[model samples]
Target chain A: MTALTPPATVTADGVIVIDHLTKRFGPVLAVDDLSFTVRPGRVTGFLGPNGAGKTTTLRILLGLVRATAGTATIGGSTYAHFTQPMRTVGAALEAASFHPGRTALDHLRVYAPQAGVSDARCREVLDFVGLGPVANRRAGGFSLGMRQRLALATTLLGDPQVLLLDEPANGLDPEGIAWLRGLLRHLAAEGRTVLVSSHVLSEVEQTVDDVVIIARGALVHSSSLAALAALAEPSVRIASPDAAGLTRLIELAGWADRLEPAASTRPGVAVLHRVTAAEIGARAFAAGLELHELTPRDVGLEDTFLRLVGEGAIPGVAEPRLEGVVR
Target chain B: MTAALRTEYRKLVTTRLWWILLASMAAYMAFLAGIMAFALTQDPGSMTGGAPGVEAAPMTPESVARTIYTLATSLGYVFPVIVGALAMTSEFRHQTITPTLLAEPRRTVFLAAKMLSSVVVGLLFGIVGTVSTVGAGAGVLALMGEPTYLSDPIVVRSAWLSVVALTVWTVVGVGFGTLLTNQVAVIVVVLAFTQFVEPILRIAGGQFDWSEGMSKYLPGAAGEAITGSSFYADSGMAAGLLTSWQGFAVLLGYAVLFAVVGRVTTLRRDIT
Candidate 1:
């Protein structure tokens, strides 16, 4: 399960496959020729900007919405084929999917029998999500954060093997977010397949092992988080009192084109792109240049995400890797 | 299937709408039946609004009992229809269908469960309607020193048939609600047709021979025919209507038609 395959190739138990999926709502295309695979025993972040078809893709996978073109399947079968769907795959598409008039316990009770769970299990899940105190309160009176917890509790009624949660942290506070991160990590640690969707990369950065980012209903980049990090340009930052000598050494080595001038407020400091700190250190020593500090700097994932979603410009990133998998 | 049915029932009972509608039906049936019984027994001549030369004919005891008992279907049928329609439409209106369909992905089986639950709710409303209408109407008849006829064979049959008629009406509401899938729109159409449109059409059906032949098949008319008695049918207006069994078949056919059409058309489309 730890083996990380190239983008769009990995498949195993609890894997989700979306192939050539196209959904057109009248003249406007919601999802266009999108394809990706989500593997089990890890948390995969489905990242995209708002209105980028993330919900539409998830809805298609769960059989709530019909696809216009291709297929979305779980474990090589459509969702509707499962005799016990809630047990096989637990999905919470939105927190607002609840009827406001029902109490939290009653809401779970409604689905518990269908999920083949006991009434006791309903109470257990309510407690698990920290909603036990208000289990009998009408959902309409609960706060948005409490409603989100209730939605999550409903998904856990079956203790499903696969979990799909979209924007699960939308209404949560900072503490609630931290709690969710811990909960997601715990769920994934149990070898369950977890795919969570969000528009903000940083919001899921600490939780996701892999990411499948899309924009305008198309796959932008799909790879392990480490692989995506490797796409950033390596650079080195050096500060020295003998800045003139450092400049001359860089000029003589024909590396001046990659050098960015030091900040005016902080003289005698420069950053060199496309080079490691070790290389800069060895060259500076050879030229007898005294360096006060030398550190490697890698661009953060937030930058990469913004660039992928067409939200910002990030120069020097390689053309995103693409693979066509028909299956 | 059993699980789906249980879940559907739980979904219905968890809300206050069903009982609220049931109570309203009971109250409305009692009031309508009591007033009708009083008018019929106290001054039979006033039934025609005292129109000149239009003397109200003296009604038999059996006919009076049948008319009073059948009010459960003739007047209170709309309650079960509303109850049944809301059973399905609330899922859409509240967006609860997302979680519901997620839990049970087989759309057909989900709909089957909804239909079954509608039958149960319909039966419940039928019982409430019957007890209130019969209890109040019979009390009025006794107060007027008239024969209640509560145990008369035809009168008894009318009471039971009224229950069956209300049950069928509930199923009809479910079918149309599924086809429409919009709570507000379904309720509007149901209220308009049952309260205004059908009454006018049924009355107009009596004015023209061509329309009268076709009007007997309308949903409300079929309901009245199934009960085998109604204040309207007591007059010459329902002279050429279909037989009682035929009315049952016609009303049941409408239920099936609405469900099958809804199943193939709107219900099969994407929920989102």
Candidate 2:
């Protein structure tokens, strides 16, 4: 209520607690007893497969959907408890969550009052999102990228302490993605808790401070980005003309328990985890196995995400990629 | 609540639907009233049965008010109802309800604000239709040297009641919108019931002794009571409808019934 600070009823540090949250739609369990906490002053990535209940959870947290059991709270209070919720939280669930006939400014105008924000602030947020040029453009005519910016502008209109964005980079070009990355980082630096959900691993890798990855309506992994990065162990990848001989020699040498199976590569390539390339090269020479390809592999966040959700986790659905359209 | 009201008001004005429906209703009522006045002036005893309501009523100043009230209710009620329906339906249709509920997650506050703002729109439509119909009716009366005493008690009472009836129609429409989120289905059902189904039922009810009592409780019949206007002795319809106050209470009940059910469902159900 005072100046720019959030109300006293709001959790002091903006900690979002999803405690034993469960949701059911007839026979389908959309969210299955999920629990996680999003800390303040950090960007938390809400990652999941397509039907992993990411959107449902977000909707529940925002009070757009009724939870069958458990609770999702912001700062120890439910979203509906806040007299002016926008003052405490700003969520951009989707870019298309606006009337098509309304212009960008008019769309913001509709919610600005509800958020206890001034008209000037709406314009400021629009300019902040680089959408000032087309402020008067109707949303129906806006491309997905522009609409995304408009949605972001709406989130900032309240000057909220917490933000929940779903797939913020979904329709953005590389530059727009980069811009959003910087924007999220800047907002986190300003002491706001930002939870952005995305199915794309690489897109959220560098931007997020922590990751809470879910698959098939269950949490696979939840850890800080730094911890996950540190856990991504480098491996030794080798392909040789006498690949069977090399595999035999490596297995005989007893590097790690077992090598990760190679795919579609001739000469039977092998990737050895927790092994040095120099040691493999030395051992392969000693065994007289002529190597065609011997390379060191630096593990990335994407690899960690893929391994957690895993291949064939959901039947008839493609596994998340470590190196995809993301640059 | 104030912020929510402002948001709903802003939403109503930003779209073209509100203004377009308002104008159409006003224009349609004005033309209908003018044509009825001209036809009646041509032959004062032209009470020869054609249109059911105009059959036995004599051309008089009091009848002018009745004509305006009846035409506004019978011919122009659709506009306000549609405006109300679209006001609620558009939020769900365009997915704007996500943002709306997100901003202020309390369902009752949001629903209440929307419902109240729709009443304002209903009032506007009713006012416009009343004025247009009265203007045309009075002008025709003057041209034919008939009485133009629009200040007669019946005209005065009927004018305001017409506005009230229109407002109730809209409030009930909001209820229907909430009950059925699918805009196309709601529109088709409402149009079918009002234009074809309900009228046919009323006509058949008028012919039978047992079913005639059931017609009094129909929404249209309730609307007539609220407007405080009833056809004369031989308008090809029964005059044994609910009293004016009784009709007001009935429409009020319908509004509360539809709106409460819709609001409760919206509150409990997920927005997906």
For every candidate, give the share of true A-B contacts it also has: 0.84, 0.89
lDDT of 1 by residue, B179-244 (tens): 888898998998998888887677668667788879889888888898888665564444345778
For candidate 2, write residues A1-327 as lDDT tens digits: 112343334335589999999999998989989999999888999998688999999999998888999999998988888999888888988889888889899999999889898878877788888888988888899999999999988887888889999998988999999989988897787778899999988889889999998887778789998887877878877887775787688768985375775542455677888888998889888988888887898888788777788744666656557785676
Q: Taking the tens digit of each residue's C-alpha lDDT, what string does model 2 give over B1-272? A: 99999998889988778898888888898898788777766764554456554335354656644664466876677888888888888888998989999887888888888888888888888889888877887788778887766767767787778888888888888878887878898889888988788767776676678988888788877877776675422244443567778988998788778879998775568888
Candidate 2 chain B has its poorest 10 consecutive residues by lDDT at: B230-239
Each model's TM-score?
A: 0.88, 0.91
DockQ of 1: 0.73
- For candidate 2, what is the lDDT? 0.81
Off by over 4 Å in 1: A1-11, A234-298, A311-327, B50-58, B236-240
Provide per-model DockQ scores.
0.73, 0.82
The superposed Cα distance between candidate 2 and the true structure at residue B72, in angstroms, equals 0.7
